[model samples]
Target: MPCAAARACPSFLDKSIHPHVLRHSCAMSLLQAGIDTTVIALWLGHAGVRSTDAYVHADMTIKEKALALNTPVTAQPGHYQPTDKALAFLDRL
Candidate 1:
């Protein structure tokens, strides 16, 4: 069949392209292009970053590259100790 011949091309071999698959492909391509997750989420009409996080979290290479680019902070991590007077003032607010 002429249609079958067209499908024989490896690029067009997958005939089961679902809408979600197309959405995922577009999101992944945008992510790989260094677009921000917030912008991608907005473009995809996601309600929040939680939805877009799946695309970012799914790709380990991006995570590794981000980690590699960050300089480690030497400052000690600790909770802020508010004085009793400051605590009382915040409580009033």
Candidate 2:
């Protein structure tokens, strides 16, 4: 957290900070900045980009944005299809 404190405000992070916390924060920041995971992995000195996958998938908010972009514009919201088993149970009820 010393790295973050030096670069920004020490009050930015409330929890106890460890040295490795900065590495994680840096990786997440890179992801938010739209840097490719592969590049981040290389920057972090990882042997393979696969090691950086955790950071790539860690943020649900990012995933939601990506999903939103991929969704068909023609598709309307709030239309959920129940599974076949659920449909059968509902019929019995």
Candidate 3:
């Protein structure tokens, strides 16, 4: 049966991809593009957000990028030295 299906869809056989694998790849692609998990779940016809969480958990690239984005600004360089006038205002306060 699988062989017949593969013959019917040559691209699938050429890529050696299964339908569920393709769906997972598509879902992961969408997640990497910053689309919300809720939207991904709906797009993939998942019953709940939990179903989509597996894709996110399995993709370290997306997780790494998201973690980088959430990193505190203080971790970066450049001290916040105020101008003379600004310092004076702070002193007044």
Candidate 4:
């Protein structure tokens, strides 16, 4: 699915680009350029600098995190059993 941010900001993005990857790249590039988080936030149309703060304080551990992201993840498909509390809530709905 296209990101909601992409849908909301058609002018800022290429229609073919996925937002998370490109957005992460853009944020990292701005950080490397020494741009302030507040400015990045405004450029990305976020409501606050806090939304952009992740890139500002990122550490070398980011490489480790990126490596983790590149690894494949597998999960066995199975049915989910909702808790009794969830069932009760669904019944109420």
Instruction: Give the runs in model 1 whose Cα sits over 4 Å from its true position.
Output: 1-8, 71-93
Against the true structure, candidate 4 has what lDDT? Answer: 0.75
Off by over 4 Å in 4: 1-17, 61-93
Cα TM-score per model: 0.61, 0.65, 0.59, 0.43
User: lDDT of each model, Cα atoms only?
Assistant: 0.83, 0.85, 0.85, 0.75
Residue pairs clashing, model 3: none
Highest TM-score scorer: 2
- TM-score of model number 4: 0.43
lDDT of 2 by residue, 1-93 (tens): 366565587665666778789999999999999899989999999999899989977988788778888889888865479999999999999
Candidate achieving higher lDDT, 3 or 4:
3
Runs off by more than 4 Å, candidate 3:
1-15, 74-93
lDDT of 3 by residue, 1-93 (tens): 457777788665667666899898899899888899999999989999999989889999986787777879867644457899999999999
Candidate 4 residue-wise lDDT, 1-93, digit = tens? 656876788664665656687888998898677677788899989998899867856745554555666665774344368999999999999
TM-score of 1: 0.61
